[model samples]
Target chain A: MINEGCRLMVVDDELIVCKRLKQILEKAGYDVTVFNNGEDAVKKLELESYDIIVTDLKMEGVDGMKILETAKRKNPDTRVIMITGFAETETAREAFRKGVFDFISKPVEIDTIKQVIIKAQKEISGSKT
Target chain B: MRLRIWHKMIIGMAIPSFIALLGVLLSYGYIDDVQKRHGYEQIADNINDHVLEVRQNENYFFHFKNGRFLDKLHKAILDLKNSVNKISSYTVEEIGKEDFALLQDAIRTYPPLINDLYDNYLEETNVTEKVRAEGRKLESFVAEKNRTSELTSSFILHLRLLEKNYMLFRNEKSFNALNSKLTEMKKLTPHCFECNPYIEAIHNLFETYKKSDALVAEIQLTGDRLEEITRRMAQRERQRIGSFLTKTKLLLAAALVLLSTLGPLFVYKTATYIVAPIIRLAEITKKISEGNMTLRAPLREHDETYFLATSFNTMLDKLQLTYNSLERSIELLNEKQAQLVDSEKRASIGLLVAGVAHELNNPLYNISLTVDAMKDELNELTEEKISEYIEDISSQSKRAHDIIDNLLDFARARKSTEMEKQNIVRIVKESFNLVANQMRINNIKLEQDLPDEPLFIKGNHSKLEQILVSILTNAIQAMKGNGTLRVSLRPDPESNRIVLKISDNGQGIPEEEIRNIFEPFFTTKPVGQGTGLGLSVCRSLVREHNGEIEVESKLGEGTTVTLKFPQYKENA
Candidate 1:
């Protein structure tokens, strides 16, 4: 209920992964956009602000790290979470250090993703008040 | 009986030696007989010579009318008789009784002739002595009467003159004159009785001498006949000795020839029987040494060679047995080696299985999360949202199923049903997914530099995926939780080949052991941690696709493996 009006973005090379994640988050009363590639998500990040950004670690052309960097640069207020098939790299740790909000490994649970977005929305509204 | 070599040798020598000995014995016997016969011949010859000498002596005694000649003749006849007896004794022993009869006849005739001659000689001596005594007595009477009566004395003187002329001449004229003178003397003797007695005595001596001479002639004739018989016996005995010698010589020669010819042949036969087997054994041994174990020595019966052949065949059998055992052992060794390779293959598949399991965990966990969320929020969800959630759930489950099927295919080693043109980059990406979770979990970094353009190759996609997965899994494991894994693909236009290289900055292999890294069961990982067949299986998989795999490594720095495949071209 606290995650209603949550602006969220999901990116993965597998369209199914992105779609499944988006559907689960949108059903939980959050605003969700799905991208099958990091490139489209990065292009959308340049024009819009979101409360949370979820992206896959590996993709064709652009990757999760690039999306994280673009989100942090365009809007310092945006919370970033990385979804990866790879869970055992310094990349996830480095993303965390660089102010990413959270890291999840695929195929991620919708509940966990929803919980993290809800938490991010509370932090944003709490900071605005 | 089984004949030993030494027995055969001894018999071989003994037979020839016996034959030679027999020849010698036969020669000795014949020669001895010849010697004895020769002795008999000598005796007979002596007897014949003595008869001739006796005859000559008789003639001389008659011709000379000397006492010395008569005495010599008597001694000669006695010697002749003794020699004849000696010949008879010798012939009796040497020649058989049938042959001895002639000698006996000679013996019997000789003694009688000799006795007759002796009797004749005694009579001649008696007559001569009587004539001389009577003449002397008449001489005394004539002397006595010459003084008393001149007629008596003159008649005695005339008789004496006639006797002296007859003794000196002894011819026919002398004989006639002596007869006339004797007649005149006989007429005158009527006048003188003393002179008549003397003249009558001389006439009596002449008659006795003629009878003695006839007996001598008969004795000579008997002696000649005896000599003829002895000569014939000697000649016949010599012929018999000659024939016996010839027979004995022929028998000896035949024996020698038989020994010389047959004895050596028998010895040679025995030698061949003994030695041929040994030679055959040697030949078999040579062949065995030359690696032909199938040959065997032939068995023989009842000889030393048979025993040798038996031993040889037994040894060959043992050798063959050992050889068969060795071959069986080698076959077992090959089977064990094959097992090792197969187990190593299973081990590598096991590694892939773990990777696949880990890979499936993500999608399965996603499915669980999505379904759980839908269950929790089902009452509030719209129809479109429910359909979307159900679709997502179904697709994620399908992903998990696909991973399992790939593993099943790899585990079964089933050939991919479909062969098609594939892009190398897509295959590499798919293989990486299986180990991507493991790689990330271990803090290993993977960097890929695949070509932008599709690198085409004709192969089964799943098998190619298996090859790449094996290589990546090895690289990840070698890094042991921390290193860089770089996969790069490029085309070589010059060779019309495509090269895929994987480099890892991990605990690189040592220089000496790097060459063995691709051999099954060769492991740098601790026991139970790695099967060590990853790289070997990778090479095999690559080769199945007409590719070559090579690795270059430096100790403590890094390892790079290059895989090359013939480029698939649309047109030649």
Candidate 2:
């Protein structure tokens, strides 16, 4: 498929969240970069662009909204997915208005994330043609 | 006697009136008796007057020497007897008993003696006439004898003159002179036989004169006795009248004395009986005014004041009833206020748990996905990879367990009021976790300046947590987008107290409004947004923790809440 090996970035304040997402998404055949904190994820976003960005909504310094804004500003085609420990939060409502591609609450199903990424991959490939 | 005021007054007036009535009756009796005595005196005086009339007529009889004078004297005596009987009718009953009887006895003897004198006078007159007639016959016989007859006739005229003198005087001296003259005449005319007849006439005349003199003496004695009896009757009447007046005076003075002394005494007794209950009620009213509400007026009198006391006591009862009801309402209001505080606590817990549960979902989702991946790779996965998956499952489980345990600790301690030495740092973190999601969602930053060293305080863990939660909730509410909530905890070395401070960079309270911020029902938040009991409830909870809370703010700048508690020295 045209979406195989598409570059993706994951950001969260929890280390286990980053580690598990990287391992599972790599085996599914997509390029994955994990960040334990939103600050590093946000800095990395400025330096290198990604096809997709998955980030935690709440972080110590740079929250998910900041990252979402930066990722969209640099590349409008870049799909930013927001992940949060809290489901249906006020920030989550605002995140959609900010053009977030997807939202995932904590204790997420890794399969659901994969299927969502696949859907994004098919759309991105179709758009480039 | 259940007397009304008017009844007592009437009795008071009637006492003097009764005395006056007694005095009037006694006076009337005295006057009536005096009139009767006057009549009795008049009766006694009339008896004496009739006796005087009898004496005057008897004198007329003796002076005139007439038959008509004797009839008049007898009529006067009869009139005296009638008057004596009239006076005697009043004797022993009104006055003069013994003296009147004596007078009656004297009057009884008077008429008899008067009759005897009348009879003697008639005989003396007869004897005198006979003597005169006999002498004249002797003179005629002597007419024949010439010179001797002339001498005898002159001597006979002289003897007749002596008889007339003895009859007119009726005294002892005149009668003795008549006898001597008779003897001298007898001596001169002895030789003349015609002179013998003149001697016989003179002898009978002397006997009649002596009997007339004795009868007059008996009549004079009876008249004297009548006069003496009359004088004594008058004296007895005067003495009896004097005693009657004395008795009347004694009774009248006694009545006056009774009125003057006992009349006022009755009035005073009645007044005291009427006024005592009212005075006692006044004292009771005074005590009630002083706030002793238990007092009541006694139902003492059967008068208008008794009704006043009953109504007054009923008024007191109603007042006490209203007061009791008011107190009960206040107690009920206090209970409702306590329930409101409890509800506030529950609302805060609900908010925390809801957010925390929702917040835990992502980690749980991640662990679930990883477990599914591990199951698919279980046969082909290398030992290192298997260890990684196992590590992920266990760590994630541990993290979920830790979060739930923290929630349980908060919930369990919220109602447990047991005081113990608690770590201020751990408590602060636990309190922050409950509201941290709200902070993150609102894009507000948390700045916790906590010492690595555990600051210890002696307090109820839940109450201390409630203080922090409530203050943090306020701080979170104060802040908006991108606001900062700063929390700091430290132990003061000098005061030996643990101090925790929570501040927010948000809209702050005005200085004047802040004074009322801790008062119940004083809300900076719009109605329904806050119960306004939050700060007051917080202050009380902090006091239960043995802590002091201070809030400082500037309008539009920020609000800082500081808590101070005595540091706990671990006894163990």
Best by lDDT: 2
* Docking quality class, candidate 2: acceptable
Candidate 1 on A8-36: residue-level lDDT in tens?
88887766566556666776777889888
Residues B1-572, candidate 2, lDDT per residue (tens digit)? 57778887788788888987988798779878877776776776777688788888988987775779989998999898876665445454556556666777777887777677778678767877877788777666655565673366666566567667776675677777778877786676667676666677676666656665566666666777776666556666666677778878887888888888887887787788778888989999999999999999988788878888999999999999998999999899778865765866775676567766865675586588678778656678999988887888887788777777766766663555678888889989888887876776667888889999887888777777777787888888888667999988888999988888899989998888989988988888877677777888888778877779899998889999999988887783
What is the C-alpha lDDT profile of model 1 across B1-572, one tens digit per residue? 88887887787678778887888888888888888878777766776687778778877876765667777877877787566555454456664555346545654665555455566666666766776677677777877767655446556566566666655564557657766866776665567676655556666655655565566667666666766766776787788788988988898889879888987887788677667767877887898889988888777655777888888889889989999999999999767754654565576577777667657866776677667667867788989878877887888889889888766655675445365788887788777766765685566788889887788887777668767777787788778766889988999899999999999998888999988988876888788788767677677667768889999998778889899988887753
Per model, the share of native interface contacts recovered reads 0.31, 0.57
Clashes of each: 2, 11
Q: In model 2, where do residues sit more than 4 Å from their true spots?
A: A87-94, B1-334, B376-379, B413-426, B451-458, B491-498, B510-513, B521-531, B566-572
Candidate 1 interface RMSD to the true structure: 4.3
DockQ comparisons of all candidates to the true complex: 0.26, 0.33
Q: What is the lDDT of residue B482 in candidate 2?
A: 74
